[model samples]
Target chain A: MTGSSVLFDAPGPKARRNSLITSIVGGALIVAGVVWMAMTLAAPRESGGITLPGMFDESRWDIFADPELWGFIWNGVIGTLRAAAVAAVFALILGVVFSLLRSSRLKWVRYPTAVVIEFFRGMPVLLMMLFILLVFSTGSYWAVVSALAVYNGALIGEALRAGLAALPRGQREAGLSLGMRELQTKLLIEFPQAFRQMLPIIVAQLVVLLKDTSLGYIVGYPELLRATMNNLSSYYGNRYLFPLFVVTFLIYLTMNLLLSWLARSLARRRNSGGGGRGRRNAGGDADVSPDQAILVAEASAAARRSTST
Target chain B: MDVVIDNLPLYLQGFGVTLLLLAVGGVGALVIGVLIATMRIAPVASLRWFATVYTEIIRNTPLTLVFIFCAFVLPYLGADIPYLVSAFIALGVYTSPFVAEALRSGINGVPVGQAEAARSIGLGFGQSVSLVIFPQAFRMTIPPLINVFIALTKNTSVAGGFFVAELFATGRTLANANGSAVIPILLGVAFFYLLITVPLGLFAGRLEAKWAVAR
Candidate 1:
């Protein structure tokens, strides 16, 4: 579908005037809201008092320069990165294994694989993390990592399964026709192509993982969020809570945006590299069919379609 | 199972809060999402730009931050909001962009001919969109909307971090109280979440299958 609609006719003079009035009113309302918020924030109130100008106070940001506070933040960052890295790697492995099992020749494997994937996908990461931490006496680090792995692993697996399903039926058939075993056909032919297609989504899921790591704060994990909160409460009490939250928000936004940028670039690279295994929508090989490829293809296509948009 | 039964009252109260948050947040998201989606596809360039910027900013940030904003920023702005209200606002605002994206795609999925036909019959833009385009788009969006609701339900657990006494918070409190029975407590908690999510998932699957045929 096209990005923008072109079905409606151009506005006539009266319609243009109406549009102008609507735009002006809408703009005014938004500007008014912003002004109101600024006024409220800057208002000298006993409770919830945070003046707009206070955000720029040199003392408010001094924590950034303090070695003690900065050290804690650095530790938090390192801790977050460590967990994310471990989770991403293991989740990728889990994704690949689940996808493989889901696509296996054995009928028994697919049912259990699907059950596990769906269960994790539907389960909240916070619930899983807290459950693991409490049940196994695992610390926050392992709790965050394991929960992320299970949830995102299922998601990535689905993406890969879709990518595999998207391939022409002939891929597996060609491998078999060439005297290759099912395992060899899958490993050499389908897996590589599927991995390429799934790369962008995998990167996007990593960004999701990073965002979820913030949930580690609920368990008292010293991640970026929890660290920032601890520093805020101790250093300034609740005086600068909003400002610190704003700072934390910006950091998370920047990181997530960077990940999305990376994913987009990967998608662009895949699209522009021209006709190879990476080429999606390769026509003319429509004849070959695997037993359950249609379902897998639809599932993967749905997953990818949601992510790409 | 025995743990769940013993803590039945606590679990029930927590789940009630969970449903309250979800119900309120779900409706709020749907309304705001449709408005944003409308702005997104509207004829006004400024509206479209605003919608795009809002969606991008909201989608890129963590939901936890959104909760923090509501819990802290709203109070900073002089509103003494309760934790449940704060959680509801956060969930609603956070989920709206995703719902908008889904609805925007649904809008796009509608045939251009549908709009053209509405115009041909002298329907104004408002009537055409509200009557013709939206009806079909809403049908197309139901499954994704359900998915968003499911996500929002799971997300309400984050409210526990903000001290909202939801199911997760309830579980945490109970587990901490009965340290030796933490496993049973968590199992009960997970089961409660599943009680909400699993049926919704099955319903979504059913709707999806039915719609795939209708398509």
Candidate 2:
């Protein structure tokens, strides 16, 4: 157990240097690629917004630099951000409600909730949004919101339930000993704790929901992806790559990269503190017990030797 | 009752297309996913980095965006691949990273000993991987990959933009022709999706249970 040989240890100086060099080279390649794209298609490509390539002129970057195209791109960004905000709020409410149902005393509540969770979880959001759109035309906006709520909420609901299950039973007993009613015990004691515990997963999934906003395009929401497509298609003769490269740089890639970055930071925050001593580790891996068993075996062996006097 | 009676065939047609797209997209995603996942975890640093960039870009971008990019943008790039082919290519590529992640986790679930054992028995890396590793990883990947399948199935709805003859698009076209009957038509489509997804979901659950440990 105390062997000096390092197995899966931290990267040493040489490895660290290699990692740094690799990162630099990768970053350089991305910049070079972007620059090459810009140089080839950026300047002369003009007028009716960015476009995809067509038969006559295959380069599509020219149209993107047009000012009018910026308007559509801007509008799309607003729509996406606005939709994501509304969905996040609704998803939180539904997530909390379902999480409560999943942990209820009665099988009726838990089983029904479980069924809904699986059904919604089982379905795809694209299908759900499409279904809600076609089925309830007036509620098209709500349909998207509902899909976001149901899907993200279900996953979050599971995260909350997992967090609650991971809680020490003593905490629940402690709440009961304090004379709180069952609902009150859950709401006042367990809910807050579980919510905090599951915060990382919750954050990451919400970012996913945010990115899922691009799914709005198919329903003609004219979101970022749709707008970009329109702008690119309009310019589909000469400036093929520029429009895509620029719009992708500004619109889809930048915003999502930020959200993903935020998710990572949030997870890091929770991970540093950890879920708690010995519950599930933050990455959702469920198999630390075997390692603990090994530790237990070593401890017992040492104890037995010490007692042999 | 009247709606169900009348719409049964409609639902069935949509269900068939749903299953077709689901099957094609799911299998394609699984294959691409393994390739991407292998690249993602490759021994070479550059390949791993490239795969990382690919997965991050794909994962963060919306599935609908990928659909649109494939259908509309690809053609404009002088890559006149037809809509159906592009839809398949895009959906397949979009779902692959997820499958890769799922399978990667599944692979990790197999203890390091299995690989060590295979190596000891004179298996090279490829033989050990395909013969020893993939079978076990495929089992563990069932549940999460089911989630990916659901995603791809739903994506068939997006193929509407590309004019692919899938469920949602079919419903959209039919409903538009019928004017404001959009709601009912969509409801029919929902029922269709439910029939397909619910059963597959159940099947995945059973598979997961069979492979799952006591924990």
Candidate 3:
């Protein structure tokens, strides 16, 4: 039952045999694909194949050991991280503001905030980057950061709103019963609890915001991808593009995986009753389970009426 | 603003290219995604592993790398596919994992009791999934599927990096032609994208509402 799919019962003897046959067939298909790709790459250069293994050549590989190239690549990575950090901060601030506005009592405030979120969510981050860059006269740094900030700000806002909406109405009633003002009750009681639920979702959106920094390359922002491309052309000409692209891809994969691991570990610690040190002492919402945290995040994203690119 | 009107035809062409990629890529992703989702749930351990690996790798890698691979790696390997074909392939392959994950979640949401009941009626594994599970799953899938499609539509802009004359590229050219009017040109491009995404987004919301009550 532990390994079983939710939709299937355990397999019987005959089903085991069928599974073996399918696995063999699947393995063959994968091998065939790899063989085809290798043959294509190993073909003659005049006939459009690289014909040379310049990518694996010691000379080309040595370029990576060069201090100048390494320095440039490091700078690009820092640029990407810096932009993402700034954008995440801005997005969180904006998300909190809009989500608060969304639940506002006034129609003018609520409706207009909804419209802005919808618009930002629908527009591509790349388009937003271009628009912001041109319209605001901000350089590439702000352009990239602002675009990511606005787009993700909308997503985080929706997630936070959903978190608030999912809370038991009695919590609000209890706060009011204590003679607290509505705004005070919300500010002191509601938002803190909602935020505890929203943390995982915010982290997920932050991963997305990080990946989007690669788009900064299109505008010559000297991010990781752009820096790698520059190094590729400068050092080995266009011939070594594939290897460099693979390297860049792996770096991104590693970063995203680290973020995911952080999410998982945080969830684990909370679920194990480790009394995770940062567990908020406020509002007695201290028992926010990790599973419930993720579920609310996903549900909120699903419940979001607005769509994003 | 006048620049937008003057270059309306150019913008329209770019818009057409974006739609073309979206239509073709959407179909390709749906087919592959369903196949991968089937593989994921299949009783074969190796096949399930394969599907898991594929999804993990593709979803983690950025779409830009996929585009670069299609644009350059294929040529390096002695294939000379057209720019549009390569771009479409990249878009389809990059997006399929997301589509598959959505469909898989949809599949999960259907009760095990439903599948067991289907099997009791003498349906095979494939038949149960296709006839009973998928129909129910797709309804649950529509909203998330729409989100994936919207992401795909926006991602098509990356084709501009590889020299496909899509909306963003059109905007770039317009900006270059009238440097001071960059604002209008970008506004026009963003408007064109909204023309496609905004309506589809609204429709998805309506559909989600329609389906929520049924669920």
Candidate 4:
């Protein structure tokens, strides 16, 4: 839906005047906030500020000129991508497995799978990582990868389950009428359809998983945030902390924005490509994030459950 | 079992801190979120731009980096906040964008006819939104808002790494001290986290079912 336009009318003459006044005021406030932040950053350390030589001072930024520092950061970038790639693969595989199990006809299979999914989803990723490291004595990298995989797998499984539930009953019925067993229908027909419908959401979840790999810092994995904030800052001294943070922040923002744009574009294509299919999946819009999609899915699923019971 | 039994007080203390963070952070996020959501819909062009930019930046950034900024950069910039206070700010600011997105979608879910009706009655924009739209919007929002808080509950763990002695931090400390009981210690931590998240999930489900607005 086109946002906000539905909430109010097009501005009349008097309303236009007031809108202009508020716009000016808002612009001034934003400028004032930025200027104040700059002044604070330029203040002395004796006043509890960061500017020993000033935040904008050339000496503070001169560290970037060093090629060795760039090499260090490149390693960090690779490290973060490596862990995310491996974790994403495992998480997708585990997600498919969990979703299949969750859709099983047997109560025994479904019940325990539900409990396991809930358990993984409920626990904090960092706690799980630390637990894996301490209990199993896996290296820090494995701990981070495994925890992310399991947690995101549970979420992805739920998203897929939602997609499965949203599918038209005819798809499944037709498969069964063709003499296909439940498992075969789900695998060959239903699951592929669900996967296609949920592709945007799965990609959105991967973006989240990528952002979460920064938690590898706590587990002592050499991810981007740790490489910059922990390792680089220590190596370059505390004077460069703000500069390092700015660089790290930009890198992450760029990567995640690109991924989010990809998800939205995929949603847009899906919406435009298959007209009737798009309308059937509730909240499967270009703007919905993975979390929101899952929430919508769960809400509908809950409604379905209550009505059936 | 004995390890967990003996360290029950430590576990309780950590659980309390986690709950406190959740409550404080949840309130902070809701307040900021509502304000941002309002700005996004406001007639002022600059306000809408500001809100959109803020939401995008926060949504794309990791919670860990947000924590680092709150815990380190704020102090470096002369904001003498404590670790716990910083943790609260980090969680609130990091989660606010999601809250705003949910609220905006809720507002979108309100029927366009309602707004037209409000306008026909000579109601101004603010009056239409507050009196007519928001009340309806909030009904559609409760389930998703609850889901956001459930996420906030798990996010509190990131604060532990930033020096707040929350549940995950306590788990780390206890695990280091009693390495042999690592399994039980981590399990205890997981149990406490589940105590918060599971109930919230169930409550959200119930609310969704009960408040299934057929629009």
Candidate 5:
């Protein structure tokens, strides 16, 4: 059966009629819902509705006409990108370091590495950011950047460790036979393969890191969400809140969707390209959510555990 | 350490609110998520389109924006929901899509032959899905679903940002007051969160192993 029609057989004439009727009813309900929301927005403030300058009122959206507003938005975009970029770089470096230590042959090194990764993964990024800000007295930007780096670095480390574990044992054996030490084998042979295999997952995690930059808003960082919602909204007054929200929402949506699309396409390419043995275990599915990648990583980790024991 | 001990009551109160948010939001996400997953696989084209659009829009937007909508925009639109209730709605609506995706993947994991067999036995879509498919799909979904909830445990902290006195907000207040004890205050908050998340994670691993054997 086709994937779409797996849940049902081909519709008979009677079934076709039933489906059409349901479609029409569903369509009507959606339209009615939209209309109801519009009416509510247009209603008076005394009735516990929108205050004067209702949503549809042209003046409510007039703030977009100011070139200065665009400048503020541009600064917010730069702030978000700057934090995300710094975090992503530090996260990758930290991920590599953590993964390397985690895969160490020494129990002392490996166990502590595992503990640290789990601790970071288990903690909330916002909590970590707040802790850094208050305890260390780092500026808000460093708090956001450092927290995102440490948290995501832990996740990426696990994913990379999974990637390393999923590699064919022969690859490592080959390296050793060619006169490489354990560290050399991992650094020169295993790490690059795991990095390439887990690239899409890393990219997906970066999207998560980017979304979390909005948490910077909570800590008083002037990121896009804070800039638009707090700065622009206060400057323009409550009447313009909805318009500012719409613009901010669109900007976040566009950036995230683009990154997500990149992640999916990367997974697809890796799947089709027949890169290496790890490909079979490396989130072969084209639509890889960050959690799904982690799930795959967890499964591989589990597999590694079972084999070792 | 003394700071945390002295503020123990405050920590417990914040912990309680955090748990309350997680419980309410988890249930809300599950209910809305299952409905959306059902729509995504339904026979009707429009329903499928609507579910897909809803999931994408919600998934791409940051949790902060969702909180902003619940905290600020809803009131402006005449929906004067309470802040706690608004936090519940924000977490639910924001998280439901991830839940839906997890369920969808679980459904995909089910063997195609099973669906074909159910259809050959003359089961309707609802009968086949609810009776045969969902039961099996949910079994496969438990581990991922737990991961989702673990993520939700951390997400409850976002409510703190929006005026709910959850653990993170409590930590902030405590840290501000006891500036010298910021470390202990924040660590106390982190301990409470680990109390929820770490166990869920271990449970997920255990269940995944058990299910793998069953499969």
Candidate 6:
């Protein structure tokens, strides 16, 4: 509160408390409405001549238990994971490569990489998928991987660029003063710092990409969604909702948990190792003094005052 | 490639269906998205729980599964919703969670002090949100919202599986009818999609840049 935030002007303690209450109240009302509606409303019924009990099935937990479904799902999951993982690797490589290119003294390599990154970053993931699908058809696994790699690779470029920008100008000057090559400055000093800062955001984007593998089903690839469709058509058409809800919860929960854990571990290591600027900032003085915090809040509030004509 | 030109009229029909589905589903999802966003951010404990469950349940599932469930199920209870409406319902619901997340994040981006100032100006609780917070939120949220919209537009191809006859279906139909030309036909479909998504992406970028400069 002592310093100005990027957004809103600051407020006094009472004002902050009041707004927190309104946020709480507004959120509460929404939850209440959803519950009232869901409980009062009936589960949607199937339109066919027959009705099935609308509940999640456990017996077909064996469907997952089945080697065939398991193989397919496993393969699908592996393919998805491998694609995302490989793409992530490629993205990292590409991001680092592009950052070095831009940071280099020569303009030749820098501008092309910049343009390529911007074009792909500006387009949607689906467009990338479609463009790749055109070459690969339904059977080409490499095509999907390539498409994901290139597009995500582009995004990593931007993340790296931003991360580099976050570094203080003094660091770059010090590296140059020490007679380091531009590449040495970037790789030895700049990148390690930027990568640490950008890791959380990059991870979040990767999770989105992981979820996006399901989009492959549109091109007739037999991924998890395809498996779900196969099961629904063969066994329990009328009970699609419950089964869908369960399967989605299970699969996504496990994957997201794993990803989150990896992210946490990475963050933890960086913090413990005293690897970057964050470590310097992590000293005991990092704690905000309440009085100064209040003053900052007051100052922040003062900015909110609009001077009317 | 030859198939596309020969069947130009039919492919145009398919493009029309694709556009219609996106428009209807996009609008429907926007309503559902806004509602769920409010729910997720609600103040009540129990109420917030419901929104959490909804987002958790919906966001995790594959969009394709939801679409299939809508297509294959719900017929046993004496209801026969049209394939288009069914597709819309599933896609709309699937996209809503994303939109909700985008919006909630955007709204959260607005500084809390703004809310305080609005209240000090004598705006009531809801008034502060609807008038002060949301305008800023909408401005911030446009970029992500555009990204979601582009994804949703592409996802409509999923309904092609249920035989809804959208652009993808038309491409597939053309592929089937004029064998070995799937590549060009899909390229045709992709062309239509790019024609739509690119402009929208640029528009959203403009909106974001404008808001960024404003703030």
Instruction: State which candidate has the highest TM-score.
Output: 4
lDDT score for residue A35 of model 2: 81
How well does chain A score by TM in each candidate?
A: 0.82, 0.71, 0.82, 0.87, 0.84, 0.68
Which 10-residue window of candidate 5 chain B scores lowest in summed lDDT?
A: B206-215
- Candidate 5: regions farther than 4 A off: A1-4, A47-51, A177-179, A275-309, B113-136, B213-215
- Candidate 1: list runs displaced more than 4 Å: A12-21, A46-59, A62-68, A271-309, B110-136, B213-215
Better of 4 and 5 by DockQ: 4
Candidate 1 CAPRI classification by DockQ: acceptable
lDDT of 2 by residue, B62-137 (tens): 6666766677656644466878788778777877777776766666666677777777788776777789877866
Candidate 1 residues A1-309, lDDT tens each? 253344557768999999888888887887798788777555555534633444445655665666786677668778778888899999999999989998877879998998887788767789899888877778888998998888888878977886787677777888999999989999998899878766776787788788788888877778888877665555666666766776777877888898889988997897678466523445444432221233223332332222210
lDDT for position A207 in model 6? 60
Candidate 6's C-alpha runs over 4 A off are A1-84, A91-138, A165-174, A231-245, A260-309, B1-7, B76-79, B116-135, B175-184, B213-215
lDDT of model number 2: 0.65
In terms of lDDT, model 4 sits at 0.83
What digit string (tens of lDDT, one per residue) describes model 5 on residues A1-309?
127477866789999999888888887887798899888776555644634756777888888999999999999999999999999999999999999999999999999998888788888999999988887889999999999999989888987986887576767888999999988999999998888778887887888889999999999999999899999899888888998999999999999999989988988887688645554554423333323444445433321111100
Q: Which is the winner by TM-score between candidate 1 and candidate 6?
A: 1
Model 6 reproduces a share of the real contacts of: 0.10
User: Which ten-residue region of model 3 chain A has the weakest summed lDDT?
Assistant: A300-309
Judging by DockQ against the true structure, name the best candidate.
4
Off by over 4 Å in 4: A1-9, A43-51, A276-295, A298-309, B111-136
